[model samples]
Target: MIGSGPALAADGASTETAPAEDVTIVVTGEKQDRTLQQTPSSVAVATGRTIVDQNLISVYDVLDRMANVVVNGNRTSFSIRGIDASNVLGGGDGALASVYLDGAVLPKAALVTGPLDLTDIAQVEVFRGPQSTVQGRNALAGAVIIRTADPSYDWSGRARLLLADKTGERRASAAIGGPIVDGQIAFRLAGEIARSDGLVRNVNAGGDADRRKSETLRGKLLFTPAAVPGLRVVATYMHDRHRRGGLYVELQPPYAPEDRVSTSDLIDVTEVKSDIATLDIGYDLGSGLTLKAVGNYSHIRSHYAYDPDHSADPGQIAVIDDPNKTYQQELRLNVDWNWLQGLIGAYYLRDDNRGYFFGATQNLSLRRLGVDQSLLKLGLPQATVDTVINLYGSGVPIVNSLDQPRVTQNHAAFADFTVPITTRLRLRAGLRYDRESQRRGIDQRVAIDKPLPDPAAYPGLGPIIGQINGLLQATAAAATSYQPERTVRYHAWLPKIGLSYDVMRDMTLSLTARRGYRAGGSGLNQQRGQVFVFNPEFTWNYELALRSAWFDRRLTFNANLYRIDWKDQQVSVQLTPGSAFDKQVINAGRSRLYGLEAEFSARPTATISLGWGAGYSRTKFTDFDVGIGQVLQSAAGNEFPNAPRWTLFGSVTWQHPSGLFANINARYRSAFYQSALVQTHRDIRPLTLANAKLGWQGEHLGAFLIVSNIFNVEKPVTSALDPDGRLRGMVSEPRVMGLSFEGRF
Candidate 1:
């Protein structure tokens, strides 16, 4: 029932039962389950009824219809094909694209926003480029798998409801499964709740500055036991909660440009909580062998605030208090003998991140001491010098704090194999050997003295209050204090290779190569108050793929071509552009990327169906020159910040058997640049989006009428510039109209 849109079940969420037709579109990117023409990388799969007919709720709406994904901030960071995985506001040591659900692994503050709920989801893979031989070191910019919906040997259920208009949204969901002991026990349950009224517009906090709420709960259990012989067990649990309202916009040249509004004098918020647990076990060592084990745990907590100087001034604001924890384990073995097929694994990870950053401190020395043009040369106007500097800078207490604790540890070993040289030639290989360690700690502080400002209530200003308290005590005596600690040890040895032939009867042809890495830590730049140690960064990928079919199968095609070579890349340099944690995390940079991907599907009759996907990339920058605040320029050739060189998506479906149905989807993108310095007014402009659904189906009831951004494109999914150069952004999601309902039992 992968619902909301890709034509597969039209809304029936059918995998054609029977062991879900042996794993529907399979290809879990080599962690077995093969189809999609026997997997050889470059993957993408979305089901759950194409995420409920493409109304996908987050994970950046499934990376905007996959195909060389990109999900920049608005859902925090993501990239693949421009290879991203870090820097959604710097500080990293892991994650270069890695997210898994059924196989656990998630918790980098739950990857910044999303309750990861697609009601009873079952399938969503996207593995493109280096996964480091089965996901090591966070896959180096590739990997996203999520699977759910297991546990049924009979009875089942479903329920859903949704409503939307512009930004007013409400949603509800439910799922259930059964066979408590019918096939040796099984159970499943799911829940969801969503709310929204967001899309910024805060005109001084008089309401809605990006509002939202989310909730989810899930449970699952499956066991096969009759006094255990071939053993099996699976268990899972999840919980999530989110509350939002922040990052509002407005600044397009001091408002007006059709001002979307935002001038928060207070109201800023963001909260999140998450918990996850998993356990899976299996055994059957008979002849063909098999054994597996998995265990995972995750916890996350976050609180965020904003308005840092996008002010109407309740005096600056800016907070973040994150807490995270993660643990994982894995052990696997599988074999099938006879012409071979294999797997072996071992993995472990531990992650813990503790964070802090508090703020309020941005008077920017009244435009660097010009003090409202010295109060209009003392005759005071300009609204009495802004009401005496907002009545003494909103009761000045100025503070900026930071505390961070990070920890990571990993150990890995992996292996993969598949062979058969005869029947149309085949071969595959894999390897992984990772060792990691990272530990960091830092605490920084700044506090602007206290209680002072009674020169008998400004009777002649006392030399402008002693020159603004001596420029706030020399900017809090040169701010940022640090107590650094470090530990870094990284080891790598990733490898993968592939080959395939049989290029005729329905075709197949392949070639692959990979190696990717990211590891190097120890930070705390605070504008070069120093404590840096950076290194690791690598990539090397080469791919070629084509999988074809035609006519008899009602057409299908796939294509991939790739190249990448990046090395040493780290880059997050911006020292002191008006304080507040002035950045630094360098490794310089070097890059190169090449890409092309394609896919097409067709059915042509029996009620029509079609699909298409496309991508093209060319991320430049080969060698960069850092230093931003005070210029050092030279960002090679730029273009690799939200990397977009082209992406297109398409879909169409129609069904009628007296139950009428229709679906259409479209997307296109091609303009990029949001950072890595190259302000052509911050670029980010290409856009096109379309979505539709029309329905009426019954067997167990269903109804739909969704339309999203059918044409109202506002683009700019995020942009920045403040530090007083003002020029804010955050747009997208302009038109929406929805109504959906479904029921089954």
Candidate 2:
């Protein structure tokens, strides 16, 4: 047995058969039900059973198993085939990739402060290339689709309890579903709660520096009325709360320490709460035509407080509050005929993001602003300049109590069609017209909290006291209290074309070309208190794919080769020398990326299975000019940040007739750079991790022992230098051994 059994196909259909190799998997990520071999795109699919069998606890865990995909150490962002989810620019209003839960698109913040735990998921699909024609705006790089289990008409329930060592992690989850009105209505409920003491120790605070706690609850209702022949309705509601401490640990002398520890006096923390609701309705009309409508709404709030200086001294503490809301609606008509299969859809979305910030100033920030240089130019002596800089370090206060809100609205119409030209050949095409508009504003106040020293006390400073006071006032006035609201609009026409050829009964070859784009928007320059707009970036992707099965359908192989040309890329550029706040997003970069991915699965025997996947990607900047202080430098041949050149994953599983099983899986990633700047590029070092599980299965209950990072490999996932000249970074989680009990009723 694999996982709980064979496995449920992507469309919620059971694929259990006499031989696991004979199971046919269906994919629904393209809005159409088709066998994996019949789909013309590059996609990675994992069923709920697979997730459970592999002990994949989070979204990142699942992504790590896929080819050409990488998740940053912090788990806040991911990259697909060399393109990051949050675009390469790193300072933009739109994302390059999108994440969908059920039928609703998640907000960007959700990806950062995630409800990432996999508790009651049904299936997960990762599309490697652009899905712009079908997903609109944010599908320039790729997309992730997650579907939770639907309510079934059978009375069934499942529960799991987990306990782990190292982090002292504990979790409990349960899901139940049954018929409420026999064959007419059904309801399902699921809930999970988890807590962990975290790994990094906070020496100054006397606790874990990165503790975590989370809770999730979800309910779904399904209705299929007998009065209306072919009508199905589903309503879902979900609530989630997650909290975590800081993410970094300080490094001792040589900038490398064997233990995870932090010296901050304050316990940095972030908490997020979210509520989501969705309704989906589908009606079948005569003549093989169907209509569907979906509506979704979500509200989220996040609170974050951290010590920026990360020092024992009470220098600066930062606090931020963000509240967001989104509403989305979509309607589509599906046509399924003998000669043609397609869908036409229209979508609308409105998102409102409101946030406020409050904090004290850090001396390092002033250094970045060149305050000392300004004092020197004002005829102040070096000693006096140093004294003034020290005085202003912790004496400045900044507050943005008023919401700096950004509201965005999107409207799109799209259509995708597949037409059979011959029995073995098919032509597929798609187009999408999208329009996006945004309104944004900023309100901030900066003040001096402590008194400045009298210039009269200094020997030669008395003559320039007025100038020094004027400079101080100007520094405090850099950020304005009010700024006029600005509105910007963007439009894009995305198109895709592909051809799929059935070379043999068990083989398929496909070639495709598609256009993908990220919408343009306005951004605020925090230092100058000014707003600026950037143009949308675009990419043209060409791909070739192959899918084949062999040896009595006992082995499967799939491969994809793709090339992407990117232009008008949005990148952050500094307008002046030595000022971080003077940076703004501009359309002044170009890049090219190419990659290949191959995966294979073999089931030589009824009780044994093996799987492997590998990916190779090459990324380089074709034309890029960035302002480093006052000089504009070119980074023509530099690789994109966080883009690894090679990725490999493999897994093996064995099961016996007596209900005993064992599984082992491992993943490897090559070294990559963490910054795009050629001068500052630092290799993040490669990593390899392995996991194992041993278990016994029965009819209604199962128990398993699992160990992650079995090698106890401890390495830095991310690293950076702090203002105090000490190296700090986040390290990989320590090895953990756990036991789980699963029961079904």
Candidate 3:
């Protein structure tokens, strides 16, 4: 939580002491919207100016610099304190981290992959901790709250373009904001377009089919009038479109990178439209009491169409359709109730998602490649049909070729109150009662009267299908013998509590414990042929934090140590080979996540500004004894996959305070893993990349040159098929260097 007072950027290990500076930033976690320096939690803020300087276009860039967070840009994988292994499905990723754009949630795990354009953003706030108490569900790790530029009765806008050299990727952006009606209403509109010639060339296909193209549009409207002094209405929407090269498994024996080919099986497509409308009503009813009411409604829908990265024949391709949707509404009213200040709020959310995956529905003849004649002439057996179905079901990941839709709903009402125990100590308490439910189901598909094309002429088909079913049926988990739809549901209630105190003249201490639950649903594999249902999981999070500033406010620091005991932990284990989705949810036992984080910002000199933040986390299975036994006992000593043991982000800004001609700024991040498998540790390691910018600014115009990955380093996150190391993922986005320009009158 942010502290409860004015905040000034502090020094390095020591606070900086120049003249007093007045800058107020909204803190996280803490009840009061205090300055960043006063926030009790380890929070980081990326100002709009900073974002512009670095060309930080998406959430990926934001997470990379957050404390203790590990991000793999390939598939847009991320984790904080090594507690993220979120499946790409609709439900939560269990990532322990959440993303909020203008206070609206980003679509599910899949929606966040590609690129996010940063055109008219106001500020980005990150809170690293169990955000359940304030953020609600899907906040197991922490929360990312992005606020875009709201409309202003005052007109404003910007148009910028960039030409890049990373395979010739070109980017252009524009935005406009101002009054829709003078002093009555305001609006802000922004859009971005970018395209690239990929690095890989499928020469056989004629061009680098691995190209990327994206376009984004966003708009906001604000309604406020002198007639309604303390009332304002805000509405916003964002639409994003993207097309990139799909995954192609480099076909090899047992499937390894040695036989790697930049396959183009899937064409990842996404269209996300978010709608948010909020009415903020504030009134002074006399008696030193201020009354306020805030209501919000939000909705999101996204779909993806692409191929798998792990196909036996890297040449094999499939067209898949995955769509996910969510709707949420919130209402809150707080008042200055004399000695006690409090707010009570209620929330409701609905999830409706559907996906259908079927391959070779549009098949091409590959029989001539490695044809087998002798065996085909002999006519092997009846089991051949079953084998083909089995292989067809499991062969392609991500494109599970099944229809499974998961629906979930949540209703909760929460309230927080603060009382002045003394001028030095303020007692705080928050309580929430939530009801969550999740339901999952699947549908199976069939081949159209598909009889073999005279196996006698195709002997190769015999072992192929036979081998397929043989490997698939190996697990009792899926009865490929039967084709039916299955459904499962889960329900739960969660609560939270906390305490805070101002211990000294410039220090504050706090402690909090909370419980968070994610409604469980059925698995996508249920569409494979059988029914498998699992229960929901919950977490009990406990934490302690300290915020302090000394040396006449020159030095400021905050640190937190936390422990979370999670029960019924959800684990995504694939039962079949080559599949990228989780097969089922098991009642995995308890686990613990503990970590420490700190941040320091200061103006070392009248002309220089610096900031540093870092975090270390150790997450492990403490007592994960499944019904069968301990699956993680042997893996106990090993660090959790995807969780980086250490993460660091730092920045330095050299400004002329005197309004000089030249100013430069820079930022960087250390390395982290990209996968959950300990054996593939080498695949994703430490990455050290930097960005620098030189610019000149004045009232009428501004210009700057931003250079990213200044060293032109190739820190490829190794995945052969998709961006994420799921199934057979591949690596993309080599060193991207571009020049950007902007000006205003």
| lDDT score for candidate 2 against the true structure | 0.80
Residue 611 local lDDT, model 3: 60
Cα distance off (Å), candidate 1, residue 624: 35
TM-score of 2: 0.94
Q: Predictions ranked by TM-score, top down? A: 2, 3, 1
* Alpha-carbon TM-score of each model against the true structure: 0.33, 0.94, 0.80
Per-residue accuracy of model 3 over 1-745 as CA lDDT, tens digit each = 1111123221000011112353345543333445664454556676665565456777667667667766654545576666663531123333446676655566544435433456666666777666665667677666777667667675666777777775687878887777768987877788888887766544234456457778778777777777876666666666766666643434333434333344444333434444445444455555545455444454444444443333323444545454556667766666565488766778787766545344433322212111122124347453653444333332323222455566667777777666777776666666666666656555554332233333344466755645433433342134233434444444445555667788888788877777766555455443245455566677887778787776665556777787777777666554432333325556654677888887665655555556667777877666645444213344433456556667767766665644333323333444444433344444465666666666765544556666666666554454443322244544434456666666543
| Top candidate (lDDT) | 2
Stretches of candidate 2 exceeding 4 Å from the true structure: 1-7, 10-22, 254-256, 355-364, 371-402, 453-472, 625-632, 679-681
Clashes of 1: 18
List the global CA lDDT of all models. 0.72, 0.80, 0.55
lDDT of 1 by residue, 181-272 (tens): 88788888888899988767887768888788888988888898888888888788889888877654774756642356777677777788
Candidate 1 at 646: error in angstroms?
37
Q: How many steric overlaps are in each model, in order?
A: 18, 0, 34
Measured by TM-score, how close is model 1 to the native structure? 0.33
lDDT leaderboard ranking: 2, 1, 3
